[model samples]
Target: MPVTVSIAEFFSSLHVSGQVGVTREALLPGDSEQTQALLSRAFQDACDDLPGGLKADLECCHAAATAAIHYLYRVCQALVDRAMSEEQVAAICAAMPPLPTSPGEMFSQDLALRHLPELWSMARSMSDSDPLVTGIEQAALRFPLSSVGIALKNSPDLLSLRRHDGLWRLYIDRIIARQDALRLEDASTALAVADALGEHAHSLAPKLAARLALASAPALSAPSILSLHP
Candidate 1:
């Protein structure tokens, strides 16, 4: 999807046109106007306490929700394909945290992220010893995003974007390979998905950074790795 309409902007425009903010009252069936308003208001409220104003909140909310929604939709569809009912779907949804207001918010604010060890242990039997695509894949197991930064792109071959550098290229290919199974993009995939991606998949940041430091990308000043948002 080439970026769906930004719920925030859509809402702002509606306000400009004299429409009120979104609310439960606007969620009338088939009322596109009301539906739009609800989405905007919900998104706005979702960020009420975050640092930046509407725009920042929207960025976080949009990213997180998309990440959560994509996975949920896929799981939901598969279950539905198997003739699952609403209750079954609800059960599965119950397994995850509330849908994030945005992918960034989930990455930055969630506490479940600290449980990656538990997640990785669970995936040990599946990927058969860290096949690849580990870091980004872990996001799913965590069930929402937490900081998995652009540093993930670093690889020894990279001329810039040194953080993730070489290891990133290989991971990207694996991610491409696994994209069908996991409904995430590089930017949106979470740490849980990375850890739980394949049993063998180790967090790529350390491995990649060690390589770059060796290849003239400055030494590992400290034990380097992907920084999770706190």
Candidate 2:
């Protein structure tokens, strides 16, 4: 029978032997593949949505994909080792591609940075005080569209969903579906997302209604309830 080695041992062997004898199964974890696939799909969708279905800037896209893969690898390594210092976090952030200023750029950057929020959430659960967690929070703030699920203490003043091309609707929907109050900063944010959904996201309306009701019941502001009507 063949031998099986732990991920740590596999990496250790690479360091000692300077050979890549391990299989993809031994190297890329399942979640890594899933994340990669999601990025691929996002890329395809973005391309399809382009005018005349033309391709995007290949060089920019390649850089985004490379950055994402590198970031994911570093994060996984840190998590596995159960140790990530502030300096390491800072290095990772510095290596990230510049913040996207356009919708197209946002879609491309999101291919990898989208995972930051969930990774940050995981890190927070491990240690709320960890520099890794705080670093991720700051990183997430710069990518609000991709970080909609993350709750920031200082929420940005994004009053219009149109600014993000309504891309954040999906993340908000997921938050609402899970009944995650913390993910939404406050009632105002939730109401804004709900209003943006309008009739387009009918399925989420009831859930949104319930969430808003529960959130605003203490204050029960008439204006907040009326905004949900029309």
Candidate 3:
């Protein structure tokens, strides 16, 4: 029931060079083996940096990594085709591993899902009306810590704020990186995250505080300033 083929044979069988200028290989570039090796290395690197308790849970990490890769591949295919039905989106979402509970588990899972925001943004740009975009948005929001770079519609729930210092620091760093693109709600959420971090906020405070101040500042006309002077 199962068939196995070498990577070269598989690519050759696809007949990638024909009247159709675009090929599956063009859609998903890079050697299959190399891609798998890269994913494996990334997973291992994340595991190495994980906390002692989480480092031992390789099974959970492996599952998360596999889910993330599968989700990415499926979503990318849909994006390339520019035709993802609501049913397809639903199926993809249903296939995702459920969000884990513990902070350690959450962090481990986010190591892979952190790349979702960029894909979500691409989907949004492609067609906000598309169900696929909505599905991707929901997925990104579900992993709040990983989706900090996204211009959130609303603040992440309080439970997301309960992350450990490392996750909080990562969140703040992403927020800082996206500071220029932050919307009003995004800035408000960043301020709340900073408040939660307290002393840990460190350099994030000045940057966020200044941005908030600028956002709250009212625009003044020359006439209004002249009237005030008179």
Candidate 4:
């Protein structure tokens, strides 16, 4: 059975007396219902003041964590029941590699690779209004291998898509420029390229914003923005 944690108990567990050196054991002098009630009321008041959106986000994060814990618990329980050897368990675990990039990616990969219906169901409970969460859900729906594309015979420099016969046909759009760089005619071309990128321009927004905001800003210099990556 799951243990229920009361607000008073939760606060008592903190035991943050610092220099006073107050321990959790010292907090509870006796079984005082009034003290517990007061602590619970204080906790409720603090929670009530928090923003609704933030609270919802916290709840969603909690749900995802709980789902992951449930998955790990089941895996451990199954291994123990089967009396699997330590080496066998290690070998099975070795197949699923970890991604240190982000937690969102990690959870999405877990849901996809484990094929956990309950985990996905829990994730779907969160609101899809956020783009970050939407990206995660889309990733979870597809197989992990599908996300990790197979090796290509030839690496292409550019990919293009055009509308032909009411269908979007994709093709390679390659142009060899002088010294592999775009020689902009004027500021108009630069502005046009920036406009075409749209939201993608925000990728350098932080760096640009920081430079502009500096008190002793250095002379401005433009970098090649038309570079393509594989």
Candidate 5:
């Protein structure tokens, strides 16, 4: 079975001390339930590594981590703080690899930017929406090669889409299309999107889409965008 989680249990699992729980819970906007669930699962897995029979200490550690995770979620919430629904997270995770799997897996993997472009690109809006993920990007440095490769090739279209202003257009069609004919639900796509976006894809899609729409332009100027993350 998919180890699904409930909002209550998710929060409880993180609150070892029961102290951070109430405050953290109090600040949360109800729309963040899904991200909360994701983080709860992540911390729960992290706590699983406690040494043999150290249940007491484990609880302590779990609570602290839970608090941190909760705090992190709160941070993510305030960043964009918009309503990024669970359906979005599930849809994204379905195509991406199992999220880090554990705490060590979370930060220890040393994942090369070369590995996760699609996920990264997809996360762009999500990341911008949630500062937690954005901050994580700063520390995690998520600029995979494939994402960069795709972004650069599409640069001309990107620049032409908008001259000097730093506006980004979000192309729902292109986004959906890129996910077509390929395994968007796989590890490669995650890595691919990140790779393609590198510094460009993730940051610029919104600009391109919005600008072209404003100018009443035909499909994006350059065909390069199509070739990316393909």
Candidate 6:
């Protein structure tokens, strides 16, 4: 029998913080205009506290959402094939290119478009392993969900992009506690996605950053190997 995996199951495995129960809204597909629009509006609502007159364009928002979905699938697929080290994950995270600062720059910029080939080449080099894929398939049986909604919740990877210079560092810190699960690469995936989405993702970036800070705060205080060492 063939094994199957749902987005929710894959997503749940990404965090060792414990599953929050994936929501229907989080699983919405990103390819369609309607879905992208919906995502854009949802992000806009999430970031309403920002300055007035900032609007999210469809193209930019769609790109952002696509990037998130793309990286999420790619990294999980990679994990399903081979176990990755913290350094390997960090290397992948480093592949994410920074976005142009303003919305106009994002829309007009070809830098992201130019970098697609390099990303594809990097992914191709990773290839697939049957045993790991099978394992992931078997694990997916316990967390199945219909494909009607989107896969990720709050686009945690993209959400982290709103933070200061500490995004990857913070993830590294959290992963010390969560290890093999919570990864700097995943945060980079989110950052790249939001960076692709440009102004569209920016509105929600601040809120996302704040939420991450709160969630990771306790992990610092909890007893861990890092604290024991120094």
Residue 47 displacement (Å), model 3:
6.7
Model 2, 126-221: lDDT tens digits are: 888876776667766666656656767776544432354334454465455544455455555677656755665446656555656566567645
Estimated TM-score for each candidate = 0.24, 0.56, 0.58, 0.18, 0.23, 0.27
TM-score, structure 4 vs. true:
0.18
4 or 6, which is superior by lDDT?
A: 6
C-alpha lDDT of candidate 2 relative to the true structure:
0.55
User: Any runs in candidate 3 off by more than 4 Å, and if so which?
Assistant: 1-44, 47-60, 158-161, 180-211, 214-230
Estimate the Cα RMSD of every predicted model relative to the unseen true structure: 16.9, 10.2, 8.7, 19.4, 17.9, 16.3
- After best superposition, candidate 3 residue 9: deviation in angstroms? 15
Please name the candidate that would achieve the greatest TM-score relative to the true structure: 3
Candidate 2, which segments miss by more than 4 Å at Cα?
1-42, 46-60, 157-161, 164-168, 171-175, 178-189, 196-211, 214-230
Clash pairs, candidate 4, are none
TM-score winner, 3 or 6 = 3
lDDT of each: 0.35, 0.55, 0.55, 0.30, 0.34, 0.34
At residue 202, candidate 4 shows an lDDT of 36
- RMSD (CA, Å), candidate 1 to true, equals 16.9
Worst 10 residues of 6 by lDDT: 142-151
Worst ten in a row by lDDT for model 5: 161-170
lDDT (Cα, tens digit) per residue for candidate 4, span 90-128 = 443343333313333333233223333332333345433
Between which residue pairs do clashes occur in model 6?
Answer: 27-149, 27-150, 27-151, 28-149, 28-150, 157-190, 158-190
Residue 49 in model 5: shift from native, Å?
A: 9.1
**Candidate 1 lDDT by residue in tens digits, 78-147:** 2324354545544544445454333345432232232232333433434434321243233433432232
Model 1 accuracy (lDDT, Cα) = 0.35
How many clashes in each structure?
35, 0, 0, 0, 36, 7
